[model samples]
Target: MRKFFLAVSLVLTSFSVFAVNSSHCPHSCPSGTPSSNFVVFRAPYTLSNNATTKFADWVAYRIAPDTIQGGRSRNFRADPLLFSSRTLEPDDYTGAHAQIGTDRGHQAPLASLGAFSDFQALNYLSNITPQASGLNQGPWNILESRVRGLVQGGGFNEVFVQTGPLYEFFFAELPGANERHTVPSGYWKVIYTNVNGNIQTAAFIMEQTTPRSSNFCFHQVTIDEVEARAGLNLFPNLSGASTVERRTGFLRNDLGC
Candidate 1:
């Protein structure tokens, strides 16, 4: 009987490991919802109708779902099983080609993740976007730099960032390898700052394109909008942000999407 009980215990332990390792476990925070197969981590705060003001609020991707990579080349769809969102449309801002003069910019610049050894992971199309070459490589990069500086200065432990496409007036669809094609009008970014051991979050959203807009004229948005659209909170204190944020961002940026 003792031997049988031990055997059963081992089986149960193995099963638990399997469940966590299976890649099907929900990794998101608004708990009880089905997990996204590819979700690496879920944020803790619930999605609010208003944009978030904190800089440290953000969500992290798990693993990419197989469905997105198959030869079909259909519209990339995030599996509902893994995430809970009012909208599941492909991240339109990422990887979409811009007009003849525009460049696809990355809010989370690829260079930011240079420290990671698995550099290929940072090349995934999911992390890219279309922006004016000057802007993307300029002010956008500046923002990233500023944030990193803050982290290094010890002003905060971790910063949460939520970014997305900004669509203003519609434009004509461009032909591409995939069926649907349209350039996002602009982009939105929200940041949550963890300062003085208090979880203070700040958000910044911007619309970068307008006929009269100068390269430096990107408009910042409010926190409420970000939370409503992103459907997730900014930070949960599992690991210390000061050490983990830079490390994880560098890993994800250098490795892939």
Candidate 2:
């Protein structure tokens, strides 16, 4: 009887790990990701960690109205599933804020799933990037909040978000980081959700130098543009063949453009 129970527990554990929301990735996770990257599944999200960059190549999550939680925490730590050398420690950002005006920015965003018990998984270093304070705390934050607002305001049943760093150029190094890694030149985010029977997407890219007072809508771009810059084909399963869908300006009405 004990053996049977143990076997059942193992099966349940495996199922739980694989059961992280399928909608989080839309039809599938980004393809053409670097071969060095490995996928990590958490309760609230899934991420592909780049071994070379020591940061997530992309973090995909779903935000439902009820999942939006109040309050936040900062218990950043290394992902235990990843090799110690392949992930950053909390110390990596010790003096980063004061020295470089950067923050341990979260790709999955605590604000998206703060109400859940596994919300801390968003704090894992593998899911973080050294985003500039102006970008991380300002426009970047505004974008995150707005994404949550879409669901909380009852506009959508769920919102899917995929975000990652863009190494267009190397940025400053962390004061406490011991591993060799490239800081991002910028960051990109692609948000999508189902409306009626159609799918809508809004993508944006922001640099570390983006003005704190600037509007996030001003930085919006096509999914193709983000794919070209980041080298990952996002939302590949989405129907159609338009490689580059550029908008003259932010035109997604639901996204408040």
Candidate 3:
């Protein structure tokens, strides 16, 4: 078991390094941060409405930040138009106007963030994704909800998320744009926690826009894989955990998540 785990870990680690080094960014912005695993492009010039017509209460922004394995963090600023003296509805949005066929998908869901301050920061357009309706509301939403639930349930307080689509074909086209941008066929999310003398991290990868299927049918990969792809380690201290059992056991016993 020990030998098998070590071999698997080495393979994953190698792949991460290779993927990061090999990936290229053709259309990334000049000021944006680019990596093989992901790219942080500049936000749209204007704010748009939420994708779901169910709500129209929030505004958006664009930001760029460093990407770490299991998550990404950016210096986000909220739109003044969306703020209210009272709690704003998460589903509420102004309407999809500026960008045609581009749905204003929330990087941080309204349900997950209730505090006015938190919502204010998360509603920025930089964090939003121009995703398909099915992909935005389906598995992507589910995964966001799950992560929020975990945080609320004391899984972790300081959690960062960086997510985007993985276009399957090199020349695949976006749903509603004249120029083609990379359409993600899969999505990646990393979660990390430090609570009560415990430290834990998790990574999830799911199909981007599969219809009628569970939105977050994810496959777990090693922390090394995540770190390599994201180019930053989540648990820098746990470098010795070479096996899944060792890594997960440590999480269960320490973080209790």
Candidate 4:
């Protein structure tokens, strides 16, 4: 078991390194502080910790038609699981210059998890970030709606969505008193589906500042780009994960719907 775990870890890291365009960090991203692997899995999604940045390294969830049947509206709040000292509060984004220019963006959106508690859980501060007003309400939102449609319309047996933020090497601060909170320069989403015995994946990234609003496919990229930029090695427990073929384009007409 020990050796097996070790081997799996090696393959997972190799996937992060080998799949990326460089053995070194990307142009603007730096490894100033390594992220945490403290993972917590819940009804809506699973997230790995990045306490230094006070956000999840990544948040992944599986959505199906039944998942969005019903949910109650709830307000965003701090994650009680994290210590108060290290967690973000409602005030963090409030007041002058604070979250003015940005929106309290959802990494894994609330609507994706329609059950009462899970829906509310998506509002936890650990899952929130400051997103550019335009990006959040514009192209980013349009694609999110499209993804939800694809699932709720029975587009696939199941769709797994993983999302998270990315920061430049030095990172940026939220405009308020909570300077500890980092403002992501960009965000990413990866969708995976298995239909008719075929596995298909589509991954994308867009700057929080100037994401394209007209075309979703314009930003589509290989999963390699997403993982490398965030410095995360996802799904190490899956043995064949490393062998999955990485593709740069979406299979629209060929998606075997």
Candidate 5:
């Protein structure tokens, strides 16, 4: 049950977007799978592997009321789910420490997963990209925290989140040997939510750079745009899920700006 979409009926609006059962889903492209270039891992949350990129192609999860808070210190480690040695290990990011100005930017943010076990799952190298200090701590961090606040105050029936990085190219002449890995030029996150009967989806993109202030790197995008950029279907099963995509952000309420 934790691995795939819920088997029970998820009546979003009229017809079910997700299949009645994960076994017989109508979607041509589900979150993750074995046949594709990415391998799927469902440790309660969904993480799809992209061994060629040495990171996750996407990480998806459904957030509920209980996801707002979880008390635990970060325990960074390698992903045990990945089978191929070609995938990155924790050691690959040793040079990406905060002291070096690059961060092991989490694609599936730990704050959103709050629970200790779920949070720990995010520490996998597959869930991270080499992000600059500014973007990691600035707009991106603020956006993650604000989402928690929104879910806490409001009553959202279901929230599906998919996050991953966007690769442009690789540069061997970067700062360190670790930098030789495929560094993403930007990152994207898409959030699907059902509130009271109406559904809304928010998408965002940010460059991999350090920001001096919050919201500086926030580029509001649409689900279609992200689909084109990420080269993957976020919710292929959704069919014509909804056109209520936003360009600005996933932030339901403003944190500061």
Candidate 6:
């Protein structure tokens, strides 16, 4: 049993040096990552953690009709696979909610994997980030729901979503954290699906101050633009420049943006 647990630990914290093997990602796990970022696979989603920020550099997951069920577990905890120096505990978010109007937002939302019994992995702090309450509850929350609608509404077989934070400018520190954990300046997301044998993609970048009622379409960007801002090579296994190039009005109508 001890050997089994040891092997499990090795598998869970598998370094990104190996190609990520998960059903959740689009083509392949994002490539061209920072040295500090390490990959950890959970039952529901896969994330690359950034030791510097004590947060994920990026998270990839797929949402299907059946996956979006059940209520939020909300049982946030530290990731056992990460070192305490590179991860946050529940106390790290103590005063943040009220003092800074920040939220312990899930990069891989729990609601998206509600159908799975082990969805608690989504609650791990390594998969959570300090996001402004307004942004987390407002446009960001809406966008997450929109992705689910695509799967539930039968508009797509499944929706592939990749998201991460942006540090374009200085950010505040989480008041409750004993260690330094800088808040993200903004966030980025890329949603993609196959339509008629062609890949259609939509991307967006939202600041921490995005209005709750903001129009989601107004923030639409290209995959390449998000790559530059977030320092990630998204969907590297997919071919064709059209998929990565900026599309001013790509999939706006389908997304109801």
The lDDT leader among the candidates is 6
Better by TM-score, candidate 6 or 1: 6
| Each prediction's whole-model lDDT (CA) | 0.36, 0.78, 0.38, 0.63, 0.59, 0.80
Clashes of 5: 3
Q: Encode model 6's per-residue lDDT on 1-257: one tens digit a residue.
A: 54554365456445555556567776788776665566777668888887788888889988888788767668899987777887899998889888888889989888877887788888889989989888889888888877787887747888888999999887578887899776899999988887776777789999988877887778888888998888777876677755456675666777787
Per-candidate total of colliding backbone pairs: 40, 0, 20, 0, 3, 0
List RMSD in Å for every model shown.
Answer: 13.2, 5.1, 15.2, 8.2, 7.0, 2.4
> In candidate 1, what are the lDDT values of residues 35-92, reduced to their tens digit?
2212221111112110111011223322111111212212334322221222223443
lDDT of 3 by residue, 28-123 (tens): 111111221122112221212222221221121221121112222433333333322212232222343243333556554444443333444454
TM-score of structure candidate 5: 0.75
Better of 3 and 5 by lDDT: 5
Q: What value does the lDDT take at residue 225 in candidate 4?
A: 72
Superposed by TM-score, candidate 3 places the C-alpha of residue 198 at a distance from the truth, in angstroms, of 1.8
Better of 1 and 6 by lDDT: 6
Model 3: lDDT equals 0.38
Candidate 2 residue lDDT tens string, 26-94: 667777665545667667888877768888888898899778886878788887677776788887788
Give the per-residue lDDT of model 5 (tens digit) for 1-257.
42232211122212323322222122333442223344444443655565556776767766667664555556777666554353666666665554456777777677776663556766766676777777888888877666555567655644667778777654222244452356677778776665565556677877675363847334667877887777766666564654544244444443233
TM-scores, each model vs. reference: 0.49, 0.87, 0.47, 0.76, 0.75, 0.91
Which scores greater on TM-score, model 1 or model 3? 1
Query: Which pairs clash in model 2?
Result: none
The stretch of ten residues in a row with the least summed lDDT in candidate 4 is 20-29
lDDT computed for candidate 1: 0.36
**Candidate 4 global CA lDDT score:** 0.63
